[model samples]
Target: MRFNRSSCDKCLDVCPVKAIWIDDQGLHIDRDACTGCMLCNSICPADGLSIQNFNFQSVLAKLKDLQSPVLSCHVVADNQAHIKIPCLGLLSETHLAVMSILAEAPVQLNLTACKKCVNGVVVNKLQKSLFAVAAKLMNGSAPKIKLIEEKADLHFRPISYTRRGFFDALRHMDFPETIGYSGGLPAGDKPKAYADKAVPDKIKMLNKILPMLPETLKNWVYENYYYHLRVDSNCDLCLSCVMICPTGALKIGGDGSTGKIVFSSAFCNGCNLCAEFCSKNSIDIIKGFSGKNPSAYASCEAAT
Candidate 1:
């Protein structure tokens, strides 16, 4: 959504089939042409793309049953020992880091078929980069999450649901249509602009995993994994950055006479919207992680 800020075109560039594109209206994906390869979903820094049926929590749930877990794409031959994902590229650094900490043994990522697949080249590179980052964030002592090219021995079993089961599921559904209301405004309330409430799931995952990492690794991630913004004295409080921030990471507040800008590093995905939009060039993006201080580098005074 902040595509205008950093001019990010990662999703468009990575589409193996050229299913993604951009225009004045914003990003667009041709669902009919999308192969569900998920390369775009994995590489988007802002978590802009998502797979409809892939529940990350469910994948984590499955990990509880295994001693040594191997993750591979469904395109790869499945083995009973390995947990298959729709695409190997779906796993982000946060996903890998969490799995590494939760597993009893080293995590194996199968990428043997990636080299030959249309989506494999970019995904293979991404897998390696994310693995390296996850490993570094865990310190040297962290379990080795290796990328293996060897084929696995696996099987697949399909489950079928009965008519009665389907009926039972329908019986429990809370249908929104059941709310007896016609299309009319409330008695006193007025319509307002829609506010985006969706926070990137990756951010939530990162927050949970950060505390479990080794102190040294945690420090490194905080210093390097996130982007920090610094507001210099050149800022005239135009508030352009605040309005453009997709994640609500930048905020402006105060009375008409005085105002201040505040930032929360935890919410920033380093899209560089503020820095890029600043007409005065007062905002600078600092690469790496900042500590718990939300106001660090982002606090600035302005006259309204």
Candidate 2:
């Protein structure tokens, strides 16, 4: 699913790789080591995920529709389509692996148009690495991989009317204007926050594993560690949280999996979209940094 405040980041929370994070733009994903279980997509609340160019059935049809270099196609669904982003750079390798297996098609990630991807060249390299691993994992039954480059107009409607308007959007988003053209904050030689705290064994283990993860999952882990949420026992299995979550992070499984909602941090963006939609007043959106943001926190944390 497309990562955004409109979606949930449950997948981001559970990912061992800490591949997910929320930025001013939206959810960013790192593709390496994603494993493609698609548990994240299934758990997403918004159903915001749609395979980039084709639906499930169409992907299945590709197995029979193959011709020349066209083996199987990997279609990505990324929410960051607004800027100059590449198609292949949209999802992590785990997402692609899920597509390769479940869709029964060799993945053909399209990156031909990413010459100036807003996400950058690093994303392109990640796509290549993940594809290789995915191909190897496919065994002898692997599908063909193809890179199709093409450009489609990004339908970014101007949030403002003029140059001042551009600054206005930044101001509204609370973004620093003087920072480098690279979308990050201004660089300084100051020490980082909370870097020298006493480390628990569990936290130490997490730190050791952090660098090995895909970017998307990594960010998710960091964000959840910084901003967390919870579900209370008062939940009524209403599926309200599931329906409202944009990224499918809140899942209501069949066979009473819905009896208790499963909150996957990997898929949550901490946007509080689910908290706003709950009927029984059973969900809470807490800040990972402070444990709860009073402006967005709810009393009872519910699930399923």
Candidate 3:
């Protein structure tokens, strides 16, 4: 968000309801008109937007036990979906990719209620993101997402397991515990400086799920979802990059040294603020995964 070299209009372009605007005070949202579609959050490379009701972690936890997963929007009543999201647009590429990776079969997505829903505009965004996820997560092979649109005003019936089968399947599955993702300060506590600018919870959750993926798929996750840094000798450990980094992706951390700058691909968020603000012009980013720990991978040592 602090990157001022060039302005970004990605959020404005994707807001289906036109609830976002900008002025001298910075970005503003018309909460009254905002439909909470979350297309802006999904599209923002820098994560400049925030939404309190977007809860995909709980949805993902429920899908983990099911061999085959079907997701639908909440507008669809009596749906056979394994779980329902507020809207399909709430899912960014990262969420969809993670879901597909965990499921054994193609992830069935029911968009049958879009046409009749007020938030139906997100359907276009959903289609684009799903295709992108398929290319990266499945290597452009058979589509990972099987979208079920309305057929002659009639929705396709997905195979819904009996409640007994649901509980029984849960028992046989050797699954780990659910992703109990909860964060925030205690009751009335307030955030200190730059706390909100730190690494996002979603990125943390993605790394938490990494170990569960197969070896081959893990490698793909590194190459696609993550990124690395390339620093030249111009860096003098001035600590500018680390301080300016909104996501805490760049930090003066090492195995056991003071003059080392660590880079975490998972927390980078593709903001490029570190490189843009670097006075020495020493830092460069190598996009795509670096085949290392996305959470904590050392790139170059700072000049002592």
| Candidate 3: residue 228 Cα off by (Å) | 0.6
User: Model 2: runs farther than 4 Å from truth?
Assistant: 1-46, 49-54, 69-86, 89-95, 102-107, 119-122, 125-304
lDDT of 3 at 252: 78
- Residue-level error in angstroms, candidate 3, position 180: 19
How would the candidate models be sorted by TM-score, starting from the highest?
3, 1, 2
Model 1 segments more than 4 A misplaced? 1-6, 76-82, 112-117, 138-143, 152-194, 253-257, 293-304
Pairs of colliding residues, candidate 1 = 78-154, 79-154, 222-289, 223-288, 223-289, 224-288, 224-289
The ten-residue window of minimal lDDT in model 3 covers: 177-186
Number of clashing pairs per prediction, in order: 7, 68, 1
TM-score of each: 0.72, 0.28, 0.76
Our tally of clashes for model 2 stands at 68
Residue by residue across 59-121, what tens digits does model 1's lDDT show? 665554455666666554433334566676677665666666556666666666777765566
Clash count (model 1, backbone only) = 7
What's the C-alpha lDDT at position 95 in model 2? 37
User: lDDT of candidate 3 vs native?
Assistant: 0.68
**What TM-score would you give candidate 1 relative to the actual structure?**
0.72
